[model samples]
Target: MHLVDIHDEFTHFMANMTCLSVMSVRYSSRCILAKKLRDCDRYTNIINYFELMYCDLKVRNESKEIGVLCLFVLIYFLFFCVVFICINEYYLPALKIAAIRLKLNEYLAGVLLVGVANSTSDFMLNFSAVRSGSPTMNLAMSNALTSICVMGGTIYVIMPFKINSASVFRDFLFVIFLLQLIRFFIQTDSPTYWVKGLIILLIYPIYLAVNIIDFLLMRYNIRKLRREIEILRYKRSSPMLDKKLYDKVTTLKDLEVDDDFKILRMKTRYGIFRAGVFVTPKPLVEPRKVDVESNRVLFHNKNNPKNRFLFTEFIQDLNPIDPEHWMFSGKYGRAALICVSPAMFLLRLAIPMVNYEQIKHGWSKLLNCIQIITNPFLVAILLETAYFTTHNNSWLINIYFDKALWSLAVTVPLSLIVFVDTRTDIPPPYHKLFSIFTIVTVVTLIWICSWEMEVIISIIGSVFNQSSNYMTVTFNAFSNAVPDMIAYIQLSKNGYGKMAFGGIVGGIVFDITINLGAQFARSNSESRHLLGDFGETIYIFLLLTVFSTSWMCLVLDFNARRSGGIFLWCLYVMFFIYVTLIEANVIHDFTADTVIEVKD
Candidate 1:
């Protein structure tokens, strides 16, 4: 053979060998992958099963069909009713029972549990979003604030009743304060003091007390007016009297009488007389005058310098302590308390939970066994604060807002949520009832919660994927907010309008403080970074919230006109524009892309 022909034949042989090697490697890799899949078949099967289940359980049977869509629409309504009834019957009662078992006072428990339940949906969504590697911290926080705004708008639009109660303002102020306080805490890189968390926790009890007191005061005033009306009618029945006699008897009604007092006589020439109203023939005992010159004991002489002073008796009465001694001594408990109470308060506020219960007993043992398990980090925070404050240069009380000490402020509460057994220490009968109740609540809540989110992501997400802002408004907003809306409507219907309003405020507060707090703890650094990036957007929403709430209160002074609702609706529109154009930064400006590009 010729040398050129031999070289060409050798080249073709090499190419064929290379192709064979490639085929062998590819087949070998496929065999390995198949072996691995067979070994992890359980996980694959589980995932596949859940996928099938989800597809089967969708609310919409066919997304494109009109008739199917109508059928699903009706089914959605039915589903909503079932969930509502489940919540009303099972969920609330379960919470109430759990709270009672937990020994939380009625109003406090109501605020905590009801607020938690209403905002649970938001918490779950935020958790899943972050865990799924989505940028959701800003979305989560803004969604919470926006929920408050939506709630206020809905209240105005539907209820149209004046919230003319001190309780309403009080709740609003408290929520505002809480939001601001949390914002301040998160601003600093310094470690937060667990004591500050304790202080925030303390606000709930005080809030509950204030609500109860306001309710009692309102009821008392109503009862008192009714009594006065009844008495006035009897007064009118009396025969016409001389103006002097009428004045005398009018003054008689003003007498501060105890329950011992009784109406002995009515409408005689002598006029009305009740026991203890008039003191008859009692000998007067005038206060002894101090002898300033002699510096000795004195008697009932009004001419003495101390006695002659214009407001001498008033001054004596006004003395917070024992005026007789003019010092802290016996009978000076009130004075001592007044003087030292603030110091004591500061002490409690700074004390660590470690110092609280080394050995938990009785009620604390029963309810807050979880709470007693103190985190070392929290104790260190308390100690740091104590040391810093007690040092000679301790004028940095204001630094509490600006600086942080080491803290398990979030961790401790998060643990309580996970580990604290609600059924712990209950007796047999109640324990069984609680178990059954809790199981039902858990199951029902789980089912509804999953369904709601699934519907939103699948149905609403598919529809509005092009515009995230639309998805938020049309579905995300309504899905999370509907629970609160239902709560408000039911509360109003049941004549607990103030409480209904309070529930909304309470729900927002709970979500922000406890629910959001826990999520932040779990993903603290990421949350902080996200907040830093999106702080402005959050503040804008917050400002809108303040304005909306203030406007609602102002408009409430008049009728809650449809105009007010329209204004709120406009405000929400502005909010969406701000979120989309400014915060989300989907659009650079108002002008068209072409115009912006030309300008550039």
Candidate 2:
């Protein structure tokens, strides 16, 4: 009994000592934390709290609202990401198909189609703004100028490519000249007559003519290159153009060269963070062969990232929108679709599906026969007692039936798109016409998605107490530019540098002339102005941005370089500073006419 009692007492003593040690360590840790907090200011305290989530800011739930911001940001990213996909995936594929089918130069097609499609959101936004009887078009004009500037700067900064296409600067020059032309029209106090707007709108045909001529010139060069390569092939007796031969043929080195003509071959230079933001030194792109005869790109491997944008890699993570995808996709694709199907159903309401080349759509006569009931879009737009009776035991068919007449209008033409598409089978030549509908539908989706995204962005900007003009210039412009920006950059990276440049500049031109013309043509009044005294400043900056880029390209002999990227970014910085000064009232150049400036 004595031995047991002695053991118990020793154990109790050890427990008490352990508890005292724990208390001492806790007290010292608290003291150290308190000292750190005392040494920090509010800004530092906030940083410390975020940097170390466990740290206290000496304030009560100051940034608890940050979660709200985060939620909104996540929502914004989702919508924004959708916009990105529509541009690159749906709209862009359509453009490519149209370009190839029409045999138009990629650069010209991008300038006309991608440019107009990309600017559709801004056009719609500004159109509605002006249609609302608001004569001020500061929001529209700011969006156009800021978008062009940011898009141009962002393209080169991300992926600089050689400006190889002939007369690429013509697009930029047209943009600048047309922009100034519109400025001259509304720069005065006279009512912006519909006649003047109509005149400005007439410039679009000339823009078309210039691009058509450029396309013809480029085609002549490409054809000449092909003929020369053919003649050289007869000498070399090479049946097909392989990688090494292509390098020689396109480059025209170590062989009889024609000094009169030149071909600017694509040279892809991957950025430091191009491969998943890691310093991976793996071969950036595999060598692929292009047959001038076939005009088809044959890849050495399936994983080649040639002609694909950076974000295209992440597309596999998203779900397919077609019902066939849900029915036929692998377990993973179906699972992804399942996760987003609810949102997709609503999103796909007015959006039509157009099948592309490799996956040409073929209407199964069986499916097309009963497509009235089988096709989701057709079923959505139509309903009958027979359908209810047939599917009554299986599922609720009424749930799929749409009562809206507009849905009928949308789905009627869309019903033809329900085709069984595969990679091996080729689609009909007539199917290329659907690219127009695809481009229009994708643009519509982008507009609706972006408009909602901007609503969320504007709310986010309001947290900083940002004014309407600031939101339009910074956030609204970004919303309009983002999908186009990423898409064009990806295209440029893929050696469509001239095409990308055309899309960027040509879109800006369309905005200034077509969109703005529509606004004034509708209102028949002077358009609303920019930030107090900042109207003329932004126009001047846009001109500078274009002029600077053009000068750099000409000086470099049309070689796209990192220095060009850096220079464009510097110009953007200067633009930002000037705009900020105006916003902050550091420089007030408001004249009598611009006093009643309209913010979005």
Candidate 3:
């Protein structure tokens, strides 16, 4: 070979190596950066999400009542649609994806994440109500039932889903008893309601305990069944075995194993434990070989035709950097994106997402610099979380659980950011150590979104002059239930009806217990009437619904058939309409005790 040719080939090899090195760095940087957040499509196309909702606005100086019909319901509903999509599509799904990474069962994931995380927003409203010395438990309790009806009830209409009869039955019984107890408390108007609430709150841990026990017993029964099968196999094969014994073994082999635990034997696996069965990830932590993607929910829907609508598909899959789904793909989309780029950039800065985002090396570097300089609040939050969750045994990691170590926290993350190379595409965001904070990061986003929801509700209520009860029952119920319904809809869509339904019930139980308890504990209302004039109508209707649900479950022998689901869903809609009419004064407000006497 010629010397010139050999030298040229060597040069070419070195160039290839350099390019590969650059690519490798970019990939790792993106992954570590992902630990910074759980990103969603909402981060992109910010204008598309917010634009149409405001296009109908007309500034009016008068005609508030007329405005209520056009502006309040229609415009506010658009706003609701946007927020609902955000929560159902991104926030809750992100939490579920995290659970999947941890390899937890779907039912358990729903109960734990959906049950507790929802309180982020609810507590804010409850806190506001308590600060005003208002009775807050009514809203929380009613919202629980509404959430179940909206989520669990709707699942039946979609498909005939058999529930884990024992677990669901236990949950329903707890809710039934608890609901009745709440009714009594409302009737009495006890000042020691806080104590009662505290007592209820304490039951949550016990509920969790029961759930864990039930899960263990379930595992044990699976083992027991397998053992019986093994014994039967041994008896069938044994030459010395008696004919009668072999015949009995053959008969026992016909025993069934149900995944949903529908049969009486399966349902009664841990009968004693059954009595107590009422209850109830980063972006991801995966092997180095597997690509770590946080938008598992988005990708999973790609192939499912049912999950897609041809019109909204683009919005659903929007990833700004990904050319395939980029808004810049079309002329109008490009123009719109450019127009809203500034707003979108600010929103991105406020809520950064990391995992699997194809952020360019150059832009990633620039963004790091820009965000650190412009958004010091983000820095402060990152620093604060790092300080507390340091995972180090050092005393410097404060035990006080307060911001006293703010200075230290600031210094540590700031110094670490430099070494973490948050500036460059390859070197920055290589902070794999910070991956643990992804939960905190996603949670912060959920919390911010939730707080924003409270603001939205407050704004709408102030405009309409709706009574607090009406606001809590209708707006609060719809807001809380919508996200939950969307979540359970996903579960049921995937044929995890049992898991979906279990989660709905468990979530309601959580709301009624932990959430309701908090409300009661915080409440200082002097009002003798907890139920406003017709508030008892909702409670009464909910009780009847619960009784009907119980009867439906029994008739089907715990099978959640479509017939039962549609019936319950229809019932819920009727209930919602009835309540709405009462609020509108179209129906009789039967209780004279409806209005709480207020101190001026």
Candidate 4:
């Protein structure tokens, strides 16, 4: 009985151990499945994240592209608007005047029309140049050249008729000769400081007065002419009279009623019989509706007076008719004319005074004080004088003598006046510094005239053979004749006048005098032999020297005190380097081409 019970216990223990092993295996399988599931979930999540990121990137790129396209469209639209405005404001008015006057021949008229059209662009360019603060000399020279090329070239190209060379020469030569002589005289004289100051102060006022007077006279004449036309329209005149008379009457009425028209009329006494009248109007025309299918107005018959009456005209004539009912009649026109004249006069006068006052104070007085202080006219005169005096020897010597005579004549009186006018507000140090700087600059400019002449002459000699050089000299002289009369515009918004002038002078001196002089001087020396053997090395050395000098100057000036000093310096340097590099590359390429040709 005992042995059987022990066997039963052993069997039961073995079964329990087997069952525990099976349970362990099942738990291990479950753990493995859970681990696999977790890994799969993580991988799925990562994939989804990547897909979302890609979608977002695509959306962002599309949005950026749309923004750029929209910007381009806006810019294009603005450009068109500007072009249309230019045409309407300037070109159309001039063209209509030319057409009416019949002064220009058919070909000439076309040329004049084109020129008038281009004048808007020219005006904008001039304005832009003035804003840029380019020295007067640069502005005048550039404009003169551009105008000559544009006008002369266009005429030559478009006109069927050949230019009468003899006539052209006769017409232009005397004027050119006189201008050159005057320029020569002006350049030699040392202008009294006081005289210069007075002239500078008075110039804008004189210009304003003259312009205002001219405008008033024009307005008056236009008004008178319009009155005469209105009177004629009211007169019981038969259509059998002059067709011009009938048209003039209608045109007068049209001018008054038309929203597009802003006419100015002036009347002059041409004895008791009739009055001399002048009329002018704005250039734009209002839009009109028409039947697209028939290519005509959707109104009554053309011959009917009712159909002929414009909508604007009908609205304007809605008031009860009176014998004295002149369109723009009574005191309205006179009052408008009077009001505008005084306002304009006062503005013109006050602006210059304000500018001078600001200058008397410090730049802190006004953020844009420098721009105001350096007037366009003053800048132009100074620059033109500098360029002509430097480039043309005869002119320089003449101007020097003239300046000396003027100085002696005006100096004492002018100085006395300035002294009397001297204010207590001016600080002693500032006054002293300003006077000294002015004196030094003037003296330096006068002295540099001779040096500039020599350098310019040398450059001419080096660049061309004798005849070509002579021609070039003549061309340059003719091109620069009317220094004072030509308009000087600014080229940049920042006041970079000093730097621009300095750079120009430096470039001219270095290229014409230093480089050429060095080459000529070294031609017979041992350095010449070395240079001949290693020409590229010499060129490289010269280039590097220029680069270093220019860089150093830029660095020094970059830190120097002036308006927009550092920023202007950096801009100029970057522009100069970029231009120089481009030019150098072009020259190098050309030289390479020539060398290859020679070898071949």
Candidate 5:
């Protein structure tokens, strides 16, 4: 009994010892795992601390980075200005020449080339934005609005003089009305989408007509007012009135009276006259009434026939002495005639007493010369010649005390020759080379400009409340519109009236539709779609801006004219003011908060 009990106790003790060893192993492993987890957590905290410090350093340096970026952008903008001015000076004439060579019809060419040329910078910017997969549709739309509202408004505020006529408001109002229609078209899926485009296309011409009519009316009113004022002034200054008044004063003095009575009479007369000195009656000029007989021109030589081919007659008909004819038409005509005149002179030289074989040889040389001279350099030379012929009649310099003028006279032409690649002696082959160089330089400038804009845009997006949607409304819109407005001024001055109108209204139309047309078409093809929250806001703001701008352009009779410029500008200012207030939470656009649910 003692031996069995001892064995049982030994077995129980062995089991207990094994259990203790297992528990110790488990405890040690658990402790090691816990220690590793604690170390991992510590490393994570250290990494987080470093990350925070890095972020703080970046925040501290952000102002400097922005400052540097702003400096670069400013330099780029200056370059952009330089390039734009050069393009304006050189590119326009070059383009006109190019168009002439292409044989584009005058009116069509004006509408397409002149109008489109002005907005090339904007087109390039938008093209780049699209290629980079940014929201270009919104960018383009915003740019248009900014141009119309902000730029238009600024011009008005700066110059708030009264307009003689208010016809421009008609076109402006029409555009605003059209914009509302466009908004509806954009928002709803109607069968009339294509119809809307057609309407937009047609509406621009009507807008142009309205502007032209208004301009003419303004000119008419100004002339009428001037004539009225002139008539009033003439009446006031007429010798007849002075003579009558002089007679009246003399008669009053000559009247018979005793000394005391005369004195009293003079005093009474003087009192009556004293009132006239302080407040005279307004001149009552008889209004010129129209008579049928008076209006008719009674020709002294109605049946006389004039010689058509006499040099004097031709000169008179051509109006060669007229400054306008000489400066514009004559200059262009002379340049064009140079090309033909050379060949004609060459032919005449050979034509006199020449054998057939010799004539053939002469003709071949003439053809070669013609080909050689038909280069862009020739155009440049022609321009220089025209400039010299008209402008050089009077010297820019004087012999005495005019060193600055002398230097200007000397250096300006030289600079033009070098920078513009204009030459009289440059040969045909070299002309082509110069043309290529010019073209390349222009393209390079444009490329650099676009790149700078993109970079600046990116910087702007990062630094401020850089939402693409809002930025489109503010900066992008303003930037794009500048080119169009500038182009309009240039083209209009050149008498390309249709072209100028097309560039502005056409740009707005194209930006609103075509830029996003592809996207919308594709999306609609796939399924029904709506813009996200940001896009919707942009569209709404755009609509509101257009409506306000249009309203500003309207007169009491709802006509458009330059007078609306001030009001248009005010609308733009109000828009920005409201936006600022809303942003600062002094106000809010509650529409932004409302969401409409659509059921599929």
Candidate 6:
């Protein structure tokens, strides 16, 4: 029975083994088939290698691009920051330092340094206008107005914040404010020359005195430091002199034995010491010699006798022959002129959205017949109506009438001359007369218009003790309207393409003037209420405006004729409006808060 059971177990084991082997073989075959299918359907090795290479290349390219872009951005940012810092801090401060060192008064230094810097912009604008054949009156008016706007606007914006007074009145009462007021009064016609001279001259002396005081203080501090050093030296002693006799004797020559020489020993309660005395040979000393002939002998190098003469000749040659060269070569003078003149031209040309390129294109051609007959006259009429409605003073009225007559006279002659000149290739004998008439007319018109605007605004403020916001808005609108009219006139006179840019200047002027004016007016009352605490926000804007205006003026003056009267008048109107807004706000605040209740 046991043999039968063992045989059955062995048979069962053999059967199970056979089944397992067959299953294993089938599984192996399926694995091989699957591998073959994958190989046939896709090029896995090639695809994987290509993908890896592509990824590597992509990463490399991406990193390089990013690095280059980052580097460029960093460089540009640093360049701009450096330029700004140098101009605002280093260059400006250096001038101030030089002025102080020279013992110039603060005002004089300011006039000489800052004024020249500032006026460069004006000069450039004026010069450009003259070059472009713009009427002198217009150029003058524009410069004056731009100056007033920059100064008054800056004060109006900054004073309120600094003083923490919401009232424009209190802000206006500051020293600068008072000075400006005084200046305004003094600017009247027929002012004594001595008064003007005194005012102008005193500025420099004040600047000089302050700087001198600073120099003295600095010198005192330096002397104090020297004294401290001397005191420190007195507290210490030299160790080299404290050595024993034996230690001090470095060589056998330092000691000598003579018949009377002796060694001595001494004993004390705390110590005993033995000493040897030695005398050395006499010290070697050189005899002093005085040469009487040395002083009389002119030491000249035989090989280089021509050196001195050559140097002298070089210096003489280098000396500037012309005064202009000397002035232009100076760092301050050149910097002031270069920086300021371009700035002024830029300022004049900068309207909102308008740049130098656009301005250049607009004024290239002279005004045409249609422009002369329609657009400018219409603009003049509208401007006059706006002025009359807001300000009704006799002086202003007369000025307005004068402006009208001048415009009409100038426009007609200019139109006729241009038409005749263009039609006939050669000017007639009376062309000179026509040209004179046109020039006179334009100049007179611009001057009258500017004077009228100023006088009218002043009269309105004086009588009403308020600014005409409505008129200010109208003036801004008119600025835009005039440009549109000019564009249309240009189209009529010289076709669309010729005067393509004529409209651009007007558009920019309108937007900037109106928006800026509105902002000033709105801020005037509020800013005054919070005086003596405003941050750099207001001043920064002022500075930017000044810079831009200066640049514009310079560029424009170089490129085109500009009407100073018109520019100045526009600026005057804006200033008047700003002042009024500030004053009114102050008055209102004062009256509203007449009584205050305190609670503990």
TM-score of 1: 0.46
What do the candidate models score in CA lDDT, each in turn? 0.43, 0.53, 0.50, 0.29, 0.40, 0.30
lDDT rank, highest first? 2, 3, 1, 5, 6, 4
- Measured with C-alpha atoms, the lDDT of residue 453 in candidate 2 is 67
Q: On a 0 to 100 scale, what is the lDDT of residue 548 in model 6?
A: 42
Cα lDDT tens digits, model 6, 449-539, are: 3222322232233223332332322332232122122222222121111111212221222222222222223332132221211112223
276-391 in candidate 5: lDDT tens per residue?
42232121332222232221222213344322223442233233133443466566776644534443343222121111111121112222222232332333432233222221
Off by over 4 Å in 5: 1-60, 94-111, 119-124, 127-137, 151-448, 488-502, 522-563, 590-592, 595-600
Please state the error at residue 567 of candidate 2 in Å: 1.9
lDDT of 5: 0.40
Rank list by TM-score: 2, 3, 1, 5, 4, 6
Best of the two (1, 2) by lDDT: 2
TM per candidate comes to 0.46, 0.62, 0.60, 0.23, 0.43, 0.20
Candidate 3: tens digits of C-alpha lDDT, residues 1-600: 699999999766643331112112332242222222212111111111111122123223335324534543454444444444445433543554455555545556656666665554455434332113224456655676576666666777554555555677677778878777766766665649787777778877877787767766665665675676566565545555555455555544432322222101011112212323221100112112212333223233334543233234323223333355353368776665565455344434433233332222112333333333334455355445433333122212222324434545464566555534432324233432222233343344444344335434643564456655666676666765665676676555544566677677767777778656775676653434344444566667777777788878888887676567667777778877887788788987546543778999
RMSD of each: 25.5, 19.5, 21.3, 33.3, 27.0, 38.6
Candidate 5 — worst ten consecutive residues by lDDT sum?
257-266
**Number of the top-ranking candidate, with TM-score as the measure:** 2
Q: Encode model 4's per-residue lDDT on 494-550: one tens digit a residue.
A: 111121222222222222222222322333212222122112322233233334433
Task: Give me the overall lDDT of model 4.
Answer: 0.29
Which of 1 and 6 is the better model by TM-score?
1
**What is the TM-score of candidate 6?**
0.20
Candidate 3 residue runs with Cα over 4 Å from true position = 1-60, 63-94, 97-103, 129-134, 186-194, 237-322, 326-466, 494-496, 523-529, 557-561, 584-600
